[model samples]
Target: MTDHYDAIVVGTGFAGAFFLLRYLQHAPPKARVLVLERGRNDCKVWQLRNRRTSSLNTEEFFINNNPEKEWLMSLGFGGSSNTWWGGVARMMPGDFQLQSRYGVGTDWPLRYEDLETYYGDAEVIMAVSGPADSPMPRSRPFPLRPHRFSDTDALLKKTFPDGWFHPATTRASAPTGTRGICCGAGICELCPHDANFSISNGLRRLHDDPRVTLRLQATVEQVETSGDLARGVSYTSDGQLRRATADLVVLAASALFNPHILLRSGITHELLGKRLHEQMPVDVCLNLRGVKGYNGSTIISGNGYLFYEGEHRRQHAACLIETWNSPFNYRRAALRAERGRWTERAFFRFMFDDLPRADNKVTVNAANPHLPEVTFNGYSDYAQRGVDRIPAMVDTLAKALPIEEIESIEVARSTSHIQGTVVMGNDPATSVVDRYLMHHRIRNLLVLGSSAYPTASPAYPTLTLSALSLWAADHLFTRSA
Candidate 1:
């Protein structure tokens, strides 16, 4: 017996969710759609368990790079959307034209205008909370008004005074479906309510959809291709080998996994696994004089993007700074014991824009082709210049605000914003995919996620990736017909 569908989607994270939503909206009612996810659907179990214990990174996936460094991702039905602190920022318009505007990196094939409408669509679906006025130009306002600044955030605003705005977040201030109003528990990594947007909120509807069929805990091993067309995909479930045929295949797996699957299928283009990179997250710890930070939101409350894009890009990579609203509770007691003083502490995170390099990439080991071999070229001098800008920013804030001593600055070992392994562009020779995210060589196969990003834009990649997925789905289904 053979199983077949009009289309098949792999992974169920940010990219996959939006792709499926848009595809279903456009596909004929009777068109069959199959979704394969390697992780189990157990959001309730995980949510309950997380409340009892501090959730750790999943060990099911591994990389050949530094063992101490963890990739900020989750292996579950909803993917990282279930685990990540939900801060979604739209890319600055200049981000789309980096190469042309600043001669710093590869230019995205599509401009911000091309995806502006889809960005608005994603914001509504995710229930984003953001200020009416933002530094970045927009076609429309966010769906919900921005949350009020927590006491801690208000103090920071008074301190810095410039380039600040309420961040766009997925945590709801009102009920949307089964999601409840956020109580500001400050442990948002494991949001107790469905307040933070996660595909788990709509998992039931997707599973119940007549056009959709879901296969959980099914690990895809190969993309079956014949001649120039993608035939389907091969996978293993419960230790049994199975194959599903489809006219089109969409890969929304992580940047590392996407290339591994393509390599297994023997579509080994040189650009397939090259130019992998992630933003460097620099953590700054401040012992404040007059504020408490632990009582409000646990993740971000506001962001500063003054250096996100400017003429300075000719000398340095752009940078975005975000203020953490949660207090330093994890280390507060320990630090108090060591220093013998009670004090309020705050954390500020700086994310430097990353540039792509040919030397940085993902590859498959000959001995074990199933596993991924990740090589990071590390940060460039341009990025280091961005890191160097932080102290001046701190100095400016300190001079204008209350007395605060900078206790420490810690550079994070890892980040969730992985990108550029399978980049998109107009030239087939220099890129893996086209503007629609379709493989230059294999037209029936499309890849989504930050993997399609030509450069690591100086903003959170979730919203842009979601928009790109919808754009690709709309073009693929509507135009193909």
Candidate 2:
């Protein structure tokens, strides 16, 4: 027996959730939808009690050949939403015009203006709090009040005034019927107070819709296509092979698995599973002179965009700075045990955007045919230029804050951000999807998420990717009902 649906959606993370949120608005009353999630639903209570997002980890589905390069994700009904920290930032206009502006990387088929309206829509749905003034241009003020900055942030603000603004975040700062006020606890993946946005807390209702049927613990093997049209997908469920067909197909899985599924289905492309990359991150800790921190209303208080946009991107990757203000900020608190040191230290995380490289990519695992083999060669020379400038960047930043000493500067092995396995562009030869995230060849197939990102921006990808999903769904099914 075979199952059929109006649409078959794979994964339930930021991309799939937002897509459904909008798709349901236009889908007809009797429309049948099938949702496939590799992991079972873990309620918010179960996640908080376990002190983690999901009991089912990423290791079960894919094989990470390069363990030194970390790629973190959760497998459950909500996917990465269970583990994401809920930081939200829009991509700069320049991010979309990278190649034309900086003579590096490929330009996205769409523009910031194209997705600007959807960005606000996604923000409203998530109930984001942010300052009026922001680095990226906005049409109107955020839905909620901005999170207040810490005492240390005030001093840093005076030092680096430009582009230093309160971060827009899904971690609640104001009262909402769905979520609680943020208490600045850094364990956001499993917020003890249920403060951060998770699918269980925010969009779980989508799966409960009578028009939709959600199947859990079903691992998709490949998409089954007829000619240039995608028919549906094949998967394993209850230790048996299963088949499903739909009028429309949405491949909303993570970057790794999205390309992996396409490859398994005999969908061939020169750049299908190539260009696997993410932002390079470095953690910097500084002991301030007589100032106290950990006083912000949210986990991350502010974002510094001084080095985010400029001519410098012509030579080096743009860098974004995230100020850590949560109570769970420091890793080695024992080192700061000297009298009054607890309140005197500040931590800042810096991330540099990296261009996708063909050498680093995903391929079908020979050992286990169902798993995807990940290979990350390394960050490009453009990104390396930013790494070499970190010491000087810190020295320049030291002049802003009254730094007593530089405690530690370490490169983080993993940013927990994976992207670029399938990118969007105007030309089918160079990219996988088109401007609306529809497959260039397979018109009925839509692939959503950070997988469509052409380049990694130092700013987080959730808000932008969620907006993309909304835009894609609207572009396709606005009149379906």
Candidate 3:
């Protein structure tokens, strides 16, 4: 490997993959890019055969004792992409200006309009299947049609046409050359059909490019900065210290490690590692009276925005509702469900948005620099209030559909969406990176992924952060060239 490179991109998940893909396309052909990955490049077959995303364990890189808290992620060449369920949704226009519109959290430096084109771009790259109609505005339609919705989702959509609709997802609705059609089996993490989008399945070409040199099992330690610019990065590989210099450095390591690397590099903004969080998820089961569910094409068949936005967000957090089609545990309850009427229930996931809290954060492990100390203080009253509104929300659902009893409502351990920590805003005093995700102190350093999120929107972060990466690369290199 060369001692110098034009650009060094870290992590190969949605953020890094999208950034590097655009960088290679927009940059001159001779431009040399170095890709650093903390995990090894394990292909889809290996992951499936082994029944695991990586050879490495989560605790090996992160240490925490926050009671009842967990962060779900895969740390390999594909990063968390290997573990996601492939449900993609765009942030509402109001999500960008939570403070301005609802008088609650802080506003993002960029708005939904700024990212509309790039959202479309990311959708096109993944060939996302979505509906012609969307709750949020879209400049262009999705590349593929929407996935089939369950009977419950059909009723919900028919009742509330404005919000409830099929979720835009990476799980293939139809057969593609690289992916098989989703069998509606709901095993997205290690999809037996190879349906959902993963780095190995979709964006492997980004690393395989002749101009790009990919180094796996290389853990980045710190960004080498000089004056107000990021020079490169220092990392370890095979128990040997290594250094690579580049004109540009992209930190795509994720919410946990991005802030840790920044702290290790001495870029200690007061809020650098603060507000380490993800959406608070609550799972609900509805014992239906007449509705029969479980007829969708993927795991999460529908999304509901009826309770997602509006003036209520001023007092409490916004909510995003997800309707699940595949109840993996249906067989376990078969005896109680009556063999012929087994599909007469609906499952849901209610995700609540949260504001940044300084108490919840990521810190450098005192014992091991390779590991991160994750501390979570817990969700705020706003999120709790949103959770408290669940019964009322269920009442709204009952108004639309047949009367049913709520079988269970339990808070999920984790959504695996690790966001915040390294927040992005126009203000340098309060934020680590700017609107373009460039470090406030270092010009050439760009921190990619959900780590830049100022506030946790009820919507999914993968598509938004992926769009931001595309927008950042486009803004930096002038894609028109």
Candidate 4:
């Protein structure tokens, strides 16, 4: 028997989970929702356990936590949020108006003000804590109190100017009171404390809802499109091919997989895989003399903004101070620096927002039938400008936090925060989805998450993505009514 649903949400990441939660909250009594995830049903905490030296040597350690090779994507129901550093912040108001201000990227179909309510709602759902009011105008105050900073973070804040340094409230999906005591274990790999919020938690909440059904280990191969409308999804689960149909198909997969799924389904959009962008993050580490565990938590606790003047006046930039060095990871990074190679230690990371370039794209692998490959041809001139500012920023940070010995530092390929594969815009011809996140061609198909963001703003995309998902769900619910 073919299963059916009011809505079928793909991928159990932040976007997927947020959509499901909002749908359940607002959808009609008869609405039935199905969520498909490629990873296991439950959070895989055991996989992050037993992090010994051998695990590090064997590359068995968690990515972000250990020196293991782990992409930002996860193999569990919660998606990357399960293992993310839990540093959540909303995109600045200027971020939405990047095109008008800088004339570089396309403007979002919706403004930051349009999403203000939803952003506030998302903060409550995610339990974000920070200053009530954000630096950005038109933003509502945070629903909950902000998380307190560690001693190291406090010292850093004292060293930097108030405008130059702001204590950003780190938001997480973890239950309140689970942080601090969680020890921030395996943060880069997985949330060792289970304090980090993952969609798995939300999925679990809907287990008894009766209206919602979650299918794990079900990898969706394609969105079966009949003409311009997506009819169903073809997935492989437990070596069997299964198909499920939904009244509305929502693609909440990460920025990486969303475009691939659309392209595989033969859904043609002019900008389907074009204009990809990721904030270039430069990690800088300095070894403090006589300070043990100087780097406290993996979560970003502070940030600094730099606004350049001139033709680039509209371009906004900021650097976050997150992630303290783990002894093991630090040692490895130091060794790489000793060998004259770029490593994570001996430097702090400066995340720079870059203008989108059309050359960056996502396409299916020719040799591999099921694999998708992403190729970022090069950075834009605006990105080059950001790169140019790195030296000066690094100098400022180095001078502020002077260390007895500078170990090693380098920039590496990051999958932690990538966005804009399927962006939303006013013109259907230029964007994959409309302002409401509905596919331009497919009436019953909607795309949620950072994938629909036109530009990756200076702040973290999770909170904004969550808010957008909620907004999309609200629209779909009202429409269904």
The root-mean-square deviation over C-alpha atoms between each candidate and the true structure, in angstroms, is 2.6, 1.8, 1.9, 5.5
TM-score-based ranking, best first? 3, 2, 1, 4
Candidates in descending lDDT order? 3, 2, 1, 4
Off by more than 4 A, model 3: 329-336, 479-481
Against the hidden reference, what TM-scores do the models get?
0.93, 0.96, 0.97, 0.83
lDDT minimum window of 10 residues, candidate 3: 329-338
Clashing pairs in 2: none
lDDT of 4 by residue, 159-223 (tens): 65443433344444234654433353334455455555455543457645788888877888899
* Reference-based lDDT, residue 365, model 3: 86
lDDT of 3 at 371: 78
- What local lDDT does model 2 show for residue 25? 92
lDDT of 2 at 129: 91
What tens-digit string does per-residue lDDT give for candidate 2 at 27-59?
999888999988888888887778777878667
Candidate 1: lDDT over CA atoms? 0.79
Candidate with top lDDT is 3
Q: State the C-alpha lDDT per candidate.
A: 0.79, 0.86, 0.88, 0.65
- At residue 316, candidate 1 shows an lDDT of 82
In candidate 2, where is summed lDDT lowest over 10 consecutive residues? 327-336
